[model samples]
Target chain A: MSVSITVGAYGVAFGAAAVANGFTVVQACLLSLLTFSGASQFAVVGVIGAGGSAISAIATASLLGVRNALYGVIMAPHLKVKGLKRVVAAQITIDESTGVALGQEPRGIDAMRKGFWYTGIGVFVFWNLFTLAGALGAQAMGDVRAFGLDSAVPAAFLGLIWPRLTGNFERALAVGCALFAIAMTPILPAGLPIIATAFIAIAVGLKR
Target chain B: MTVQIMTTLWIATLGTSLIAFLLKYSGHSVPERWLSHPKVQRINALIPIALLSALVAVQSFSEKSQLVIDQRVVGLSVAIVALLLKAPFPIVVLSAAISSAAVYNWL
Candidate 1:
């Protein structure tokens, strides 16, 4: 319950940030409703907010969403759903749900299933609610930049990625990627520099 | 002109959502071994880190086609401090916003 709420409540930041980037409240809500993945949704708004092209936004968001595909692979057999239910299951096969389900592995498959459903549904409900609240709140604020909400974009990204920098190698690679992106900012278009960093990762992976 | 921009944004928004859903659904439908290749998994694991780190940099320091060092830097610095202190997500983000706003107002 705590995990779901905590993760879901971050939707407030997303909603506000989306509006700060010029998305209408409905658009912001729709992103959360349809995309549902935090990082991918953020990439969409962030890229477009920076005046990137639609292709760039879609490319960046799809890249961030690759992990969900992996998560679905992990959960499919265990979930055992089909047809419409399979679609629903795919929608909610996110980081929190997958982690919670896996954490319950010691208890048995039944417990794991329950954990997955409860966390997924729990997060979904709270996320949409908080997103609505946040969009409305940000809309009321008028000048979001005056509140330094622009700064919130990078800060939010930092918060999301912080947990994943678990090892020295990962941390170093992140710093390198950040520097590389900064260096390429002047040369590349709005969103291309960030996408370019994927090559660095692929190179490292292949080398290893 | 405004309609054109709005139309573009709407297309991007819906298109991104569709791609995201399809990616997730494909995982369940596709054979596991296709994705479970050791090289594939290894590269996939590193992709988010690279992309997100670059995103943080790009968002924080770039404007249009130029690199910048501005109040957002001050804000991001404070955010790093808050994270180092093990602050909660909201607090980390809020502190960054507040401090950056303060800088923007006073300076």
Candidate 2:
């Protein structure tokens, strides 16, 4: 519940950012409702808002969405849903759901499944609700950036990713990827640098 | 002009959503052996850390085509330290916001 509410609340920034960038309230809400992935949704608005092509937006969003597929692989055994239920499950398979489920490892498989269902549904409900609230609020705020909300996105993201850097290799990879991306930013377009960072992981995997 | 832009936006949105759906659904379709492959596991473990780190760096420092370090970097540093100290999520967010706001106002 806490995870869902806090993370979903960040949708306010998305709402304001989306509107500030020229998306109608309806379109912003639709992005939240249909996509339901915070980072990818942000990527779409961020790219397009910066006057990049829609192709770049979609490419960036799709690149980030690839992580969900990995979460799906990790979750497949635990979920075991079939047919339409599988699709529904897949739709809600995101970072929070997967993390909550895996965090229950000490409690066994059934707890993990329960955690998955609870967190998935919980985040879905809260995320959509907050997205609407954010969209509506953005319509009223007029100038989202005068308040410095732009920084909130990266700050929140740092908080989200910081806890996961458990070991030296992970930290090193993260630093290396960050430096590589910073270097690439000058030569590549906005979205490509992010996508290019995936190669660092590939290289690390190859080395391993 | 408005209609053309809207059309492009909708198409991009739909296409992006479709790609995301397909990626999620493919997980169910892949064979167990393929998923369990050592190479796949290694890559999966590293992807999120690398991707997110890149995101943090890009979002914090990059401004359109150029990379500029600004108050957001300070905000991110404070958030990282707060997180390492095991500060609550709300506290981490609030501190970053407050600190950034202070920096923005004063400097």
Q: Please write out the lDDT profile of model 1 over residues A1-208, one tens digit for every residue.
A: 5675576558988999888888889988898888999999888888887668889889988988988999999999899999999999999989989999999999999999999999888888888888888888889988776788888888999999899899998999899999999998898888888888888999998998
Candidate 2 residue-wise lDDT, B1-107, digit = tens: 98977876786677778888888888767876766678877786677677767777877788777878778777788888888789877677667766776778789
What C-alpha RMSD does candidate 2 show over the true interface residues after superposing them?
2.5
Please give, for residues A160-183, the per-residue lDDT of candidate 2 as tens digits.
567768889989988998888788
Question: Judged by TM-score, which candidate is best?
Answer: 1
TM-score for each candidate, following the candidate numbering:
0.97, 0.84
Please list the residue runs of candidate 1 whose C-alpha ends up more than 4 Å from where it truly belongs after superposition. Answer: none
- On DockQ, the candidate that comes out on top is 1
DockQ of each: 0.81, 0.55
Weakest 10 consecutive residues of candidate 2 chain A by summed lDDT:
A141-150
**Residue B42 error, candidate 1, Å:** 1.7
Instruction: Please state the error at residue B79 of candidate 2 in Å.
Output: 2.2
Please state how well chain A of candidate 2 matches the true chain A, as a TM-score.
Answer: 0.81
lDDT of model 1 at position A32: 84
How much is A133 displaced in model 1, in angstroms? 1.5
